[model samples]
Target: MTSVKEQEATRRLMVFLQEWDSAHKVARSHILDNFIKSNDSKTEPELELEFSQGASLFLARLAAWLRMTYTYSTCLRKLLRSIGIFLSAASGHRYLIEFLEIGDVLILLEILGLNYHKEEDKRESVKLLQLIADAGRKYKELICESYGVQSLAKFLATSNSAEAQEDTQILLDSLGHSNPKYQNQVYKGLIAVLPCASPRAQQLALQTLRVMQDVVGEAPTAVVEPVLGVLRSTHLQVQHEAIQLLKVLMAHQVRPALLEGLVAFLTPSCRKELTFCSETAADTATLGLKEPKLVYTQQAAAAKIVGVLAKESAEVAEELIQMKVVHGLMVAVGNLDHVASQRYASISLEYFVHMFPFLEECVKNALGDTLFQHFMDSPETWYTKMDPLQAEELASIVIDIP
Candidate 1:
């Protein structure tokens, strides 16, 4: 370890480099800039010469200081950000990569771990991870094997910070870019984090999975299963996020067993919401006052699932048509808050009108002509400006009737 006095001297030296404007010595500054701008491949030698010319001692001292300072030190962190700006430098890139290999990553990982205890430190940890990920992409094999991966995975597993989770996704993305060899490592980390991850993390993980699936041609069934399991997750957001990912897996043409399991894992309300059984089919309307919030979420999730299913399963679409979802929505339009309730009821209307051609018969049977006349008669009740879309959809429905 460097002595405290030496450390202070190095700290002062780093400060000196920061304030040492090359304009103070224009000749040297021009020489340095020219060397960097040189397109000649042979300029590498001259570039090194220029970089070494006056700042050589300063650069050497700075690199030593960086290597000496604890990774937790504020000065060292600021220096890393400074180094990050010059990472495009051929020599600078090589030097930073070398530094990463020689314990820089371990230190960074330690900092990332600190994110759990210190909210303020989380951003620094994310920045460090971003730098590692940006540079590590070029050195995939090393990065996959680096301390950064384990640290990142561990942080991803536990850190609640949205930024940390997003950074972890980026880090995994970089790993995916590096080599196919790290694909399983990335998948493993995601799976490990899935059950405990925050809603945002879960969403980002699904996004990462989608990109990885494209990159790797097809992800392993093992990978797909864990994400499929997220549908059964207790978090409503996780359930919502899983919908699209599950669609991807299904579209990828998953194994029948996996598909069956995925279908089974679909929450009961989600399944009910999507299938839209006959409104007259006591089973559909009998859905009593279950949690009102859940009722709304179930309706939204169902509508999305129904839309996706309409593209694939005509039977499911036919079932949705029979369920009189339009009537149910029109009814819902009157029950709750104007803004949120109306928004979903309007969406349900859009899906209803667009997806089901036999919408009139379904609506008539579900809401008998008497009730239909009442609803139509109460035009003013439906006239709430909160749901202009509902009005538009209703008008379209009325116009389509022969």
Candidate 2:
């Protein structure tokens, strides 16, 4: 079933591969010209016929050579790119199972550790890893078996290209969802990226972490500081996501740090600990209430979190009372300019006042009897995600405490 041209091409490739090391440049040129479509000067049908006759054997031989070369040499790079071209062909996915069978999955993953290679090389490795993972669950687990969780995490954190990081996130999210065996490992890896210097990297990590929350179960204590640290982000989406993750990660062991960190957001030192995440972000740490409209956003989100925590556990409520969360809430409640902050601050304040009524007189003293009455009876002001007030009109509830 073979033609003279096909057999002749295959023989040349095989011959070239034999002396490939001693005369790598010549051999590489011969192999590329004979097999790889772009490098081949042959007409399309001629090239197609030759590859059909020996794609499998050529790939197998290349992979064998690929496995034998541990370091990133020019010859190895050429071979790797050739394989990528094969994998990227129109019917490329057809070779995916064969690729896995040939031990290319682990080989490609090993290539990722060769940091000296161009990012293009690492990205190609990831692309192959992706194809392997996309093949099915067993292949996904195979990646996990090959120390994938750590490797992918390091790549995600360290990859300079945003596109590469995004691809890495997709791969991680895919792996995290199905591998029950490696779910926790994946979770730990994602958490490791949260502290990375790139906000985009941190954002991508958080997005994946959000999807993984329910599956990973109660998070470890290690998740506490970095996530709390994320709340300091000026990035609203970042803070918003951190809040969502906190809702799931809550456990008794983490509550002490969690509560203390949340209360610290209300403390007066907010700007001191404030890390600029976005143009609109304010300090969540110790900047206190008087900082700015930006600070109001952080305090509002922090207060909202406190309200949810308090509503869930009376014991948490008691602890927050001891922390004097009321002082910050009062400052938030008085901030008439940023009603978004006022709305969230008042909700948490209501929790403190309702659950521990002894704080009522102090609350009344802070807001005056009229504002206190409005806040308690208020429909629009009492709960979550309030709309911003119109520039021309203020909330009827805004009243100066006498």
Candidate 3:
């Protein structure tokens, strides 16, 4: 079965593999340089055909070399570069499948787990993994089955490089689309990175979660709890993103815990407590007190979530009413300093009145006539920019209350 042509090809491949495994850095470089140069002029088909003969053996040797090389060794980098070159040469689904069949794909994933000191190496590892996953759905499924999603998540959570995280996220997203089975794992991975000190990681995690929300469905309280904590993030964009995710999650299923969390933000006393704590901490900073504060945007977001929840059903509205949310809404709407919060608060109030007409008395008592007059008299000047019908509806609620 061993023809002379096959014998010569295996011998040449072994020579190249031996050169790659040499202890001298120059020998490894010579092999990589020659390999890249030789492949430069070859088309994918040509490269595929040339390598198809001894591809499995070549990859097996490469994997063994990779396992033996120290993560930070120049030899490891050269080996990775050589693999990348080979992958570039074999750029087709067919070759990708061939590589997968021989366990090279798994080898690439294992390389990713190594604690490489260089960010470039990390990025390159993730890039190669991404290339394999992009080859086809079957490749993606294989990656997921091998715990690729979990590995990427761990990498994402710990990686300091934005480029590396982005690459990993792309792979995870691809796996997510290729198979629904990995949704929960993907979700957990994204959530695990949410609390990372790196803002970019947190943002990428949020963005990925937003895209994966439909597939993720109702996340566990542990997952959702961190997202809620992200609401307090100093970054405005992060806060907005968290709010958007919470809205989507709430829309899918009304969680009482989420409702309770949103309602807490609507409380004026709670906001004041935050402010008071902040001021007191500033005064006592010399004594090591920490400042705690909630931005108006957060309050606005909470009110918006409330409006969305109330619009879902009368029972939800009644739930908020029972929580005494009307008092908070009244305070928010009458606070002219924050127009956005006022607007959302007004929307929530409208939902309350429309859902449970009896709550009108509670709202009326909370606002009193003078402030209610201010609410009605200068509708044009209201920063919320309420339309005439909306303004009228709000006015009708207060006016017809008797």
Q: For every model shown, what is its TM-score relative to the native structure?
A: 0.54, 0.65, 0.69
Error of 3 at 4 (Å): 12
- lDDT score, residue 209, model 1? 71
Best to worst by TM-score, what's the order?
A: 3, 2, 1
Worst 10 residues of 2 by lDDT: 390-399
Report, for all candidates in order, the number of backbone clashes.
1, 7, 0
Model number with the top TM-score: 3
Native-to-model Cα distance after best TM-score fit, residue 110 in candidate 3, in Å: 5.0
Q: What's the lDDT for residue 253 in model 3?
A: 53
TM-score (C-alpha) between model 3 and the true structure: 0.69
Candidate 3 C-alpha error for residue 27, in Å: 3.8
Q: Which window of ten consecutive residues has the lowest lDDT sum in model 3?
A: 276-285
- Taking the tens digit of each residue's C-alpha lDDT, what string does model 2 give over 1-402? 888977787787666545554555566656655555553234333434655555656666667777777464665556766676556555455556566677777677777777777777677678767767776788789999989988888888778888878888999998988789888989999998886656667788888887887888776888776776666555666766776676655643677777777776654234336422343222333334344544455566777888887887788778777776777666555555667667777777876777776777776655555555766787346423222442112222332221
Q: Pull out the clashing pairs in model 2.
A: 234-277, 268-286, 269-286, 269-287, 270-286, 270-287, 271-287
- Please write out the lDDT profile of model 3 over residues 276-354, one tens digit for every residue: 1132212111123223234454467677667776776667777776676666665556555567778888777777766
Candidate 2's C-alpha runs over 4 A off are 1-23, 26-50, 68-70, 74-81, 85-107, 250-257, 268-324, 330-360, 366-402
